[model samples]
Target: MVIAIGFEGSANKIGIGIIRDGEVLANVRKTYITPPGSGFLPKETAEHHRNQVLGLIREALDVSKIYPNEIDVVCYTKGPGMAPPLLAVAIVARTIAQLWNKPILGVNHCIGHIEMGRLITGAQNPTVLYVSGGNTQVIAYSNKRYRIFGETIDIAIGNCLDRFARVIKISNDPSPGYNIEQLAKKGKKYYTLPYAVKGMDVSFSGILSEIGRKALPQKATKKRKLDQEDVNELPSHEDLCYSLQETIFAMLVEITERAMAHCGSNEVLIVGGVGCNERLQEMMGIMCEERGAKLFATDERFCIDNGIMIAHAGYEMFRTGTRMKWNDATITQRFRTDEVEINWEVGKV
Candidate 1:
């Protein structure tokens, strides 16, 4: 069996995986935490990646009980991420590949998520809802391409969650998304947040701004401010969280249902970090069941960002002779899934 080492440095996390014949033998992930009171700063993210990537790769190899020389191929995330972080991963993969005298393959980060979902779920031609910190879209396979049928016109759902978490001073926690999800579960959907969708594309910035406006008091006079104690008791934080989730997830479901109708595909698969959202999954499950469509979600291991997806995609590329020169392999923050022609034989489902 040919063993491949996969590297993922798309954003805040550094992940490494070892795969043999498309089977993930080991998956190691390293998360980079920002400083106190800081968000995902590009420079800080890159610097953190430089520190943890090597260790992540080592951990993967160690967990898999495979030496570096045993690997036949090296795969690294190529793009659609922060430039510095992507470059950091590439440098590590390139150096390792050169040292090991193995072929290096670059994989698209978004496609990796979809492909990994496909692998884990054994879904062929499933409509994909790829939601992450950087992206939110409904994708489907047609005419030999993963086409984007629906997406956010402005900020992605994950970004919206991050911003909301920041506003509530919970963005720097161990898992802001998880914290928001927990809070959202606690309260009823009281305030009706805006649900904006144009054609198949949804917009969250307007909804976010609207929620901020509603959350802020109309009057801030000294006398009114003196009633801050009572003011705080008025609006329920959990209610706001619930409403935000309902609006955003309902929009996602609406677009996904529309896409399934347009594409004539009954199967849908959810991928990316935000795909791990329980409420989103439940909503999609209900919609798909009502529409007589199948819905698949990756397990936690496959749901969040990871390196095995890159390795799986790279193996397929390698099998198809999609070799690239050093110059040919460059970072791209706007790479789309439909742009590439994939040969799936190397990646067995």
Candidate 2:
């Protein structure tokens, strides 16, 4: 019977959601789109969030049909995200908390994604493969902590995909990664790229560099003068996209399976921006089927960064008597996945 409002602006998107208990009342969100071949910068992203925050908050409450006084607490993403964007959301959250006279809790962005996935997909104690632009990790719940089993030693999977998308000059209207996934479906040839999986951890920097330098055509003029051998060596943008996805996704699947084996868990839950990819889901599903396990995933609604996840996770923490003072509701750029204590793990199912 607790209603909470959550503010999420840890990246290019700004979202505000209202939730009652485990039910979503409203989830409003908007992404700051950049031109093709460009990524959204922190300063510009923060400005976009600040401009959209108040309107989104009002819309969320209006759509929820819940009054401000009825809301039990306000929650905002505290860290593991872009500082400017995160701080923009935090300032508004703190101001509203003070005005509304409600408690505020700063949520870890990664846990918000995980908790929301469990709530939506109903997967209890599943091995979580969290993939996003800024972070990548295979995690499991142990001893009241979302213990991280493996992670990216360098750049994240989503970052790799996004950078590749930029190299291919894909549109950023919807999302670079989304456009890359679309192009990948049309790929016919599979040019083998460097696969860098070191034990349970993965690395993407080398493969990304390799693709940009040799496997793909750099200039159109150079492409025209290519000999048969050179032409054969260079793959189409489609094939490059496909190879990149397959190689990276395979790396992710391997690590996720390793984590599952280590934990002896039969369920695999995929959550985060990159988790919205249908191909990745299909791949993970195949792996899960081979292992006689279940694959728990969600569509873009729950997979991409959104306000509902923040609100739902806030509710979980709030139910467990979690509280944050106004002064403590600060943002951090490097919050780790295993830092937060999972006190609300009593009845996970």
User: Candidate 1 overall Cα lDDT vs. reference?
Assistant: 0.82
The candidate maximizing TM-score is 2
Candidate 2: give the clashing pairs.
none
Each candidate's clash count: 0, 0
Candidate 1, run of 10 with poorest lDDT: 340-349
Residues 205-259, candidate 1, lDDT per residue (tens digit)? 9998988766666665566563667577556667878889888999999989999
Using alpha carbons, what is the TM-score of model 1?
0.93
lDDT of 2 at 98: 93
Candidate 2 lDDT tens digits, 238-320? 88888889999999999999999988899999999999999999999999999999999999888889988898889999998
lDDT of each: 0.82, 0.90
